[model samples]
Target: MGRSGLPPGEDIIILLVEDNQGDVRLLEEAFHDASIANTLYIVNDGDEALDFVKQRNEYADVARPDLILLDWKLPTLSGEEVLKEIKSNSSLEQIPVIVLTGSEAQTDIITSYNNQANAYVPKPVDPDEFIDVIRTLENFWLSVVRFPTHTDED
Candidate 1:
């Protein structure tokens, strides 16, 4: 059971930070097909992602996500910046962040890891492959990892 008092693999929340509409739609479809009973929250830019995680402005009522799927390239803050902020903050650092990006560059991968991103996956061009990746990701992160119960604090 997690901090939420739910059994393992139940009621996990994920925050996806991606600006591309098409990619967002594809991820949504893929997550649905994966059949995981988890809530996915979407933020279109890095700035909004920060706000959501910080529980500020319009996001004060939302819960902290169990996982974060971040795109390295983003408007406003950039995923790298968001990752750094999350890792540096004591209240949010426990959540695992995965860098899901279109760039396969070695620099992007290294930078993401340096910033404490838990995993890096290049965005697959094929929809089917992307869905499979999501399924695998769900199986490992949600099923295998034991997350700390969330708390709201500085």
Candidate 2:
């Protein structure tokens, strides 16, 4: 068993779909001191993010994410489009997706929820607050809630 206590290859897995370098760096730094075992996979744009989640092309060997943290604004396909795609697909729909972005627009919030986002978190401007939020999110989503570790056999 690993540090998270499931199995050898099963550590808490997270996929972050973000384009901002600073935001990405901050998120990485926040997870550096995490208590549980985890692996964070990053995809800078929506297209690449979709490819990674679908396990297509270069992402064929990548582990499926237990949770996906997605930024609302992304290049190529927008986060809204990605969320719609993920939710519509049967194989991908079960993965909990949280919309983590700086935008707090009422429309964006409403749209995210309408499209079936598991949660929507507004990014704090202060780095310390951001880290604190990440830690709190990690504690709740990773430790408290149980995600499906095994994919159903096709």
Candidate 3:
């Protein structure tokens, strides 16, 4: 069980769909600092993230994530596309998705919320602010929110 008391057998899994290596490193450091116990599964592109979530082909053994952090811009399929797919699927729609992007545009924010994103966060330019934002995210989602565990067979 995690510090959040999320059942004894279930694991807290986070799926991060981002392409930037620097951002990935920063997120890793921030999670460490926050002392959140969870498994982070990373994929560079949106298409691969979708495949992992669906447990397709090479990702047959992939575990269902408790939450997803999606980036706006990606190499193959865009983050919006991935979000749409997840929200449209009955089995996956219940999982919370936090749209973490560098985009601060109004249209992007509106679109993200329209697509059933649980929260939208604008990426901070400053490293310290970025870490703080990550910490806040951990505090809210991990410590406060209650997420469902995956039990049904895919």
Candidate 4:
């Protein structure tokens, strides 16, 4: 079995809602070496993130993600707003959504939890540290937890 607890060939799907291109690349590199098997789908803006999760427009045929990593700073709609929408939706609420942002603001952390975020993680400044953080997140979220399974056909 893979680290996520699914049978050997199955892969966990993760949605990353981040606008920063540099952070996205770092995440890609980190996931490339992660111990668990995962398919990371990225949305560069908040609007696209919502659309992707809600399966709107171009995202209509995509598989629903088992986990989500959200960033606070984004273009168009903000992360708080996106988090609210996802949590309010019955179909999407079961998927774990973690707020992964650079801000260590008490307000941001509180707001994320208020909007029903499953967890909150601060971004590390150093590139190597950032990768290590991602690996740690993957280890706990992917290896330790048994992810939700969607019964609906994709």
The TM-score leader among the candidates is 4
lDDT per residue as tens, model 1, 1-154? 7534446666888999999988899888877665557899999999999999998999999988889999999999989999999999988898899999999999999999998999999989988888788888888886678777754444
Clash pairs, model 2 backbone: none
Provide the lDDT at 92 for model 1: 89
Q: What TM-score would candidate 4 get against the native?
A: 0.94
CA error at residue 83 for candidate 3, angstroms: 0.5
Query: What lDDT tens digits, residue by residue, belong to model 4 across residues 1-154?
Result: 4556566778899999998999999999988888777899999888999889988999998888989999998899999999999999988888899999999999999999998999999999999999989989988898899875567742
Q: What is the alpha-carbon lDDT of model 2 when measured against the actual structure?
A: 0.90
Question: How much lDDT does each candidate structure score?
Answer: 0.87, 0.90, 0.88, 0.89
> Candidate 2's residue-wise lDDT over 78-145, tens digit each?
99999999999988998899999999999999999999999999999999999999999999887787
Clashing pairs in 4: none
Candidate 2 at 80: error in angstroms? Answer: 0.5
Candidate 2 similarity to native, TM-score: 0.93
For candidate 3, write residues 1-154 as lDDT tens digits: 4445578655578899999999999998887666657888889998899998898978888888888999998999998999999999998898899999999999999999999999999999999999999999999998888886567664
Error (Å) of candidate 3 at residue 138 is 0.3
Give TM-scores for every candidate, taking all chains together and pairing residue i with residue i. Answer: 0.91, 0.93, 0.93, 0.94
Off by over 4 Å in 2: 1-9, 152-154
Name the top lDDT candidate.
2
